[model samples]
Target: MRERFDVVPLAALFLGAASFLMPFAALKENRVVDGLLLNGFQLAGPLYGTVAVLTAFGVLTGVFLMKNGSRRRLLYAAAGVVCFWLTAALLVRAGMMLTGGAAPRVSPAIGFWGLPAASYVLIDHSKKGRWRMWILLVVMLLPAALLLAGGRGEAISVFREWSARKGRFFDELIVHIRLFGMAVISAAVLGIPLGILASRDKRIGEPVTAFVDAVQTIPSMALFGLLMAPLAALSRTFPLLRAMGIRGIGAAPALIALTLYALLPIVRNTVAGLASVPLSAIDAGLGLGMSQRQLFYRVEWPMALPHVLTGLRTASVQAVGNTAVAALIGAGGLGIMIFQGLGQAAPDLILLGVIPLILIAVAVDRSWGFMIRRWVSPGLDMKGLSA
Candidate 1:
């Protein structure tokens, strides 16, 4: 069966070559020499036609190379790629029409559509080991090629223009980073100590946990307002702690608010993780002549790390989103863009802020989740780890 199937690639090659040549032949028949003369070597027509041919050839190649059981899978993937490109092309056409078809460059939808298909083909073909590196190399390089070919000067220019807004950009970024950092650090410093105390004594644990749970019950915006006065007062005493040199009403209040909100998850997770350590394990460590410090470092902490990391991940993502609310308090970040857009009724500007915030939250969550699943979690390998 493998020997019979080996002819498939050869057949695919012939079919692909025929499909490519046939399109050019059809184009040539339209006004023949005059059409060729008008296009100055018929460049643009052939370029577009070539992309269409290559796209089809990729699908055919993928079909021929896949095993019978996997052929359906490959076909589905090819269809998906084609659908993606078609939808993107349609959207681009729509956008062009909306803008009176006078945009400086091709629609971004083309790159968005084409790159994935090319990457899929490169990755699929490279699996045989012989061409794997070359396939990946092309996949990596194809974006730059497409970018150059598509003449993304306007896109680059827009970004360059935005880059000139460095003050607002950095101001927003720095404010958010500081707020998030303060939230995480304050939660860790305060929560870890409370976690240890709670683990040591139920009397302290119950009341503290109840208070944190109560705080958690409060809506975030309400809590932000509730804490602002107290935090604003504290900021008066600590001149160096103010964010952006705006003393009373900026990131200081936001940071304190986020920190208070972050504490419950961290402390609760820490307490639970520590408490989950078996009593027998602790007794065994003691019986083996382990010191209190030794037991905690060697056994308890290692066992608890996965849960702690989980809490941290949760807190980080929460802090990221919550920082947007801080914008209401003049703690400027991407939220500034969101509010600016809202005021101006510009969805694009709103997206500029909201999209990056979502991306940052997701990226941080995934990366930290991977770290915990891979290294921190006990008795699990990569294949079994939850995403």
Candidate 2:
């Protein structure tokens, strides 16, 4: 019997190979003037041999996927991708080491960046279960851990930026976290009640959704600009609020904008989850002398929780991405590094911000997904939502 194989992962694997052969990073001086573009072949570090080995394994895994149809094969492919990812990081460190510690700026080029997408495609194609959560976490963290253990070259090069500002990097990182957390909390607080109200009353539902939907349509910068007038005026009118850090161009407006953007998903998911609850269950609860509150808390909330959680996951991811925009308004997140990089024409500085943002978003999205799979509903098909 001939086995049917998935073509996408196979294609991605070859693409990853093509990327590997290409220039992985550019060696620069002082993060401004580009020095030399270097491919993986140029820097033969201690792990250079391992990089070649993993690259071969990735190629073979793709071939295996093409010839065989099994979840096990896909898992192996994912493992290969993970190994390849670590290889790229080590390759960067190797390149830096080859530069002989001139404090060269190592800017990751196309190949270094593109590997993650290929890895993601491979992993997403694989059939996952509750047991795979640990594997997934390990896979996610392994690259960073290995890079750390691989050599000091990687750490020193990356942390050079951190060293420039002393403790400021940590301070900005905390600000980013606070911005994300506050927006999500506020959106949830408002969205859940609005969702419940909407579900309870069609009359109220249409307008509330329309308003949030409208809010969603406004561009981030425009929304930030729009908030400035009122917020600034309010700050001027109330010194107490101004003293409390409720400024127009800082965290306050940024938080408000992100919260508004977040409301739609949370509200939509809450309504969707609640609406998905079975009428029979509700009637049974009613028959059991359950009050309206009891009926919702007992029957509706539980069933709807999984969906609501899914929405929160979506909102949370969106919030992370959007918080970067908040940096434009002086809210001060990782986006500060990004914009400064752009202004200075420094790609390495840009990556310093972007890499962390991507990691944070992915971490939140995956953790929420894992929780949903484990605690919400093991049987729920997450593919549609994820896709």
How do all models score by TM-score?
0.64, 0.85
Instruction: Judge candidate 1 against the unseen true structure and give its global Cα lDDT, from 0 to 1.
Output: 0.60
Model 1 residue 92 CA deviation (Å) reads 6.6
Best by TM-score: 2
Query: How far off is residue 197 in model 1, in Å?
Result: 1.8
For model 1, residues 31-69, the per-residue Cα lDDT tens digits are: 112111111112224666567657656766666666655
Residue range with the least summed lDDT across 10 consecutive positions in model 2: 150-159
Residue pairs in clash, model 1: none
lDDT of 1 at 382: 29
Candidates' RMSD to native: 10.3, 3.6
Please give, for residues 193-216, the per-residue lDDT of candidate 2 as tens digits.
Answer: 999899999999999989989999
Q: How close to the true structure is residue 331 of candidate 2, measured as C-alpha lDDT?
A: 98
